[model samples]
Target chain A: MTDRLEAQFAFLNEADRLKSVLRATTLCDASRPENSGEHSWHLALYALVLADQAGPGVNIDRVIRMLLLHDLVEIDVGDVPIHSQNGTAHGSAETQAAEARAAERIFGLLPGDLRDDLRALWEEFEAAETPDAVFAKSLDRVQPVMQNLACGGGTWATYDVTFDQLESRVGVKIARGAPRLWDWVRCKVRPWFG
Target chain B: MTDRLEAQFAFLNEADRLKSVLRATTLCDASRPENSGEHSWHLALYALVLADQAGPGVNIDRVIRMLLLHDLVEIDVGDVPIHSQNGTAHGSAETQAAEARAAERIFGLLPGDLRDDLRALWEEFEAAETPDAVFAKSLDRVQPVMQNLACGGGTWATYDVTFDQLESRVGVKIARGAPRLWDWVRCKVRPWFG
Candidate 1:
């Protein structure tokens, strides 16, 4: 095979690792925690179905790409739930440090151009600044909440996630994506939370 | 919620069905068969890592989107393995008829505009005519072959798939997308087959 195909195959083979990286969120059936592979897959579909919810004029393609690449770092660092609460910002410094390294290593396995492009997509998902990013973030936060609600308060029951923590961590982003889903979920879920 | 978000949510909720739709190909480890969800996920990542192999000037985004939506119809119709020959084409006429109906029903859950757009993407994947479609088809063919090789001739051993059968069935599409990988696999896997 060609050199580029070899590099591509290597990267593709490495991606199988994501299937084994389990998350804290249980499946809607509560049979097992969903792996990063299926979560990212489900998130990409969520981006597709919910693109309109991401505010007017957002680029759905970019958001879909962002969702596809988002949890790849979890292949390296494992999933850190939104409620991990390390007494720090979005994630603990140690976790962020680990993910950044994981991103570099995993994405670097691709040839330079593809590697740069994918790494850029991962960064875009992390920055959550662009219209696409904001919308992607909205759906990202929404999935687990929907899963939790779907399965009679999935992981949240274990975490005992309070209304305030959920509001600050998830609702803030939902409000940007679709104020309606935000309002709807709050009414549905807050009663279950402490 | 607005009508669009409601439609989107209903569609998103329904996407969980994909996780249960089993495909014929096993995971790389051959421990169990793969689901459409994670297979789609792996294929999207394959599009990213193998974008360069699609030759110059292909739309990587379109290819990625196609792969993501490809098997969604399987959620309704269930997976049809490439080797499920009943003296017809890739799949039986009944299977194709069922899939078309399934596609319409599942995608119809989305708001009209998004539903039409996604159904178009799914058809593009099915047609595999455009440059993006060709590349997407190419990777789709490559994935199961790679998985079989990874797991020491996974399903091929079970079915006793021959070199000639694989050549006609899979290699035709494989040649279009990545010929080198195709040529390499022929030499490597022909020994496993009769």
Candidate 2:
């Protein structure tokens, strides 16, 4: 029991490091770059607030869980912004491999059952295979766009992101899980992109 | 549908303000004061990581949900630190009433059903009634202590907090829902307070 409790505390302490892991997207207020921890929280809220707009069969609860656990890998690999370097490394084989290794070491800090469960959830999110993961991924994309739009093309301006690039890189994934949300975001961001 | 979507977006955008609402507790690294948003997120992670330590019958999913919604009111009324002003205003009647009003106005921005659902969750967290709420409240108190411990008395030193005050103000509630966690935390934080 003592060992197990120590392991959990160690994992939680390591998780605290995530608060210092900055992302490419700044806060909408443009004060500073949002950390992965808060970004994950905001995305979970997005899952709850926008659950109605999700694709059919999506489990909002699971979507929320996925969102909460999704970017934890960023603690290890660092955030690979979707628009960074023309979006080449965002879903690159190298990045995915790094994130998988990160998931193992980080989640492995927990006891056996928890390590397996969280690793699976992180994998489900990486795969983006199920309805829950799809919806979670959609919000994952939707949030940065919303942030960028709110901050006057935050990362877009910094990265010199083009409309075509956004469409191919971010729009399709968001649309795949929540078409109406994509439509709403499209209308809001199109003017800036053009 | 458009109105509903707009309402959701408005509420979420307003929630963006929460990221700006700072709390008394600093980050573990002592970099800056943690915002209510990330603080809430860290608490949610604590709920997940420490579920085994919670009282029997605590539902972690509900605990996570409560943590996520619990601090949105800070966007309006601002964070009233538990140890602030010698812990007088933390749960003062004026603060409770103000938070109730804040909850109504903030959650009310959502469409009817979601507004009720989230508002009710927020109230449940505030009331700390059910097993889940009890567990959620426990994590709320636990995270700050952990942060303070990690940061060399982050809030305790800032507030000149004492051992007796911490036990009465924070320790009892944490013990109620997670006695083992409280035990571990007590061992860690006792020296700092002394």
TM-score of every prediction relative to native: 0.91, 0.97
> What lDDT score goes with residue B138 in model 1?
85
TM-score of 2: 0.97
Q: What is the alpha-carbon lDDT for the whole of candidate 1?
A: 0.81
Model 1, A1-194: lDDT tens digits are: 36776677778877877877788787777777888898899998887676656677788888888888888888778888777653144477788899899999998888888889889988887877887888888888889998887778877777677788788878998888767778877887877864
Task: List the pairs of residues colliding in candidate 1.
Answer: none
What is the Cα-based lDDT of residue A54 in candidate 1?
67
Best prediction by lDDT: 2
What DockQ values do the models have? Answer: 0.63, 0.71
Candidate 1 RMSD to the correct structure: 2.5
Q: Candidate 2, which segments miss by more than 4 Å at Cα?
A: none
lDDT of each: 0.81, 0.88
> Could you tally the backbone clashes for each prediction?
0, 0
Instruction: For model 1 chain B, give the 10-residue run with minimal summed lDDT.
Output: B83-92
Candidate 2 Cα deviation (angstroms), residue B149: 1.0
B69 in model 1: Cα distance from truth in Å?
Answer: 1.3
Model 2: CAPRI class: medium
